[model samples]
Target: MNAIEIINISKTYKSKTKTITALNNISLEIKEGELFGLIGPDGAGKSSLFRILATVLLPDVGSAKILNYDVIKNFKNIRKLIGYMPGRFSLYQDLSVEENLKFFATIFETTIEENYDLISDIYKQIEPFKNRRAGKLSGGMKQKLALSCALIHKPKILLLDEPTTGVDPVSRKEFWEILKKLKSQGITILVSTPYMDEANLCDRIALIQNGKILDVDLPENIVNKFDKDIFSVASDNMFLLLNDLRNYSHTLSCFAFGDSHHLVIERNKADENLLIQYLSRHKNLSVKKIEPTIEDCFMQMLQSEN
Candidate 1:
């Protein structure tokens, strides 16, 4: 069964002098019990789409349904069935961690004790600091507390928007582990993130940018779709090597990737020997064929669109 259905959803924000389209004819269906991800950078309409699903914001030109309930007409029912954690930490900062959790549980007409098992794995980590004010806790601790409150009502669907942004790498890993546990219990999870590596952690992902969806598929499948030869090239003069590679006749595209530059060349038009000879002036020059990553595919898609 599809837990969420969105059809031709478009939202635009208009000011006196300008209008910005947040979502552009977006349509997607998320199956029940699936862990789906929306992958994109900031200002990509991720939060806007999430808000529409959470029933807090309405689309200007389309319809959405959650668990067979129309988002606009059955908002109350949808609100009760889903848990939403916005990109920002929204819990009352002045309240103690325990108080925040209890407050959310009360709003849903349920006690934390009733759904303690659902959140125990996450809550226990922050339990030692239950009396601490929410604003005083560390970033990772704040994340755990927010998640505990979201799950306190035993929601059927979870909408987490960029939950790991600005968090430590270790905490990010731990949080994803908790998500896997939640998925096993049959909760449909929809999470958005700017991290490309995190895409592999999801069952499926939608690559969104500029209020538009670039592609939607499994992580491996998306990587497989990149049908170009890419080579990792490095030289002592990194800056000069980038410009030199881009100017080469066979070069299709080139971008800096950490210590090396990923250079895409026209099929059968260029080889390592030819590149080596061309850049022989630079010291420690090296080139090797490599596989494409999720970010590589995303950049390829963006290049195609342009």
Candidate 2:
């Protein structure tokens, strides 16, 4: 069964000076128990779409359904069946971790004891500090506590918006592990993140930008769509190398990635030898072929639109 359905949804925000379209004719289907990702940068409508599905914000046009309940009319029912964790931590900072969990459980007319098994693994990590005030906890601990409360209700669907942003690498890894465990328990997850590397963690992903979806497919499938041969190039002078590469006639695109620049070349016009000879004018330049990643695909998509 489809856990969520969005049909031609569009949302716009108005200010005294102008209007901004946050979502543009967006439509998608998320299968039951699937870990689906919405990949996009900030101001790219990821949050807007999540809010609409959570029934906390209304779209200016179109509609959406969560677990077959209409977001507009059956909001109360939808709320009862889903656990939403917004991009920002919204828990009570002054309350103790245990108190916060108890409060959310009560709001759902449920108790932590009733859903202990669902969140036990996560909750236990923070249980030692259960009496500590939420504001006093570390970023990672706060994340665990928030997730525990979300699962305390044992909802069928989980909507997490950038749950790992600003978190340490260890915490980010641990968080995804928790998500995988939850998926095993048959909970549908719709997570959004700006990190391209995280896109591979989901069963499928939708790439969004400027309030529009560029593509939706499995991570590998999306990477396979990149038409150009890519290479990693580096030289003693990085900044000049980037500028020179952009001026190269055979260069389809070049962007800095880590210590090297990722150069996508027109397949018909360039090869390793040609790239080497072309950059030989600069001393100590080195180039090597590299596999394209999801980030490469996203950049290609953005380039096409421009």
lDDT of 1 by residue, 142-197 (tens): 99999998899999999999999999999999999999999999999999999999
Worst 10 residues of 2 by lDDT: 266-275
Per residue, candidate 2 scores C-alpha lDDT tens digits across 1-306 of 799999999999999999999999999999999999999998999999999999999999998998889999999999999999988977899999999999999999999899999999999999999999999999999999888888888899999999999989899999999999999999999999999999999999999999999999999999887878898999999998999999988888899999999998876567688767878877788888888999988988898899
The count of backbone overlaps in candidate 1 is: 0
- List ranges where model 2 is wrong by over 4 Å: none
- Model 1 off-target regions past 4 Å? none
Most accurate candidate by lDDT: 1
> Which 10-residue window in model 1 sums to the lowest lDDT?
265-274
Clashing pairs in 1: none
CA displacement after TM-score superposition, residue 114 of candidate 2 (Å): 1.4
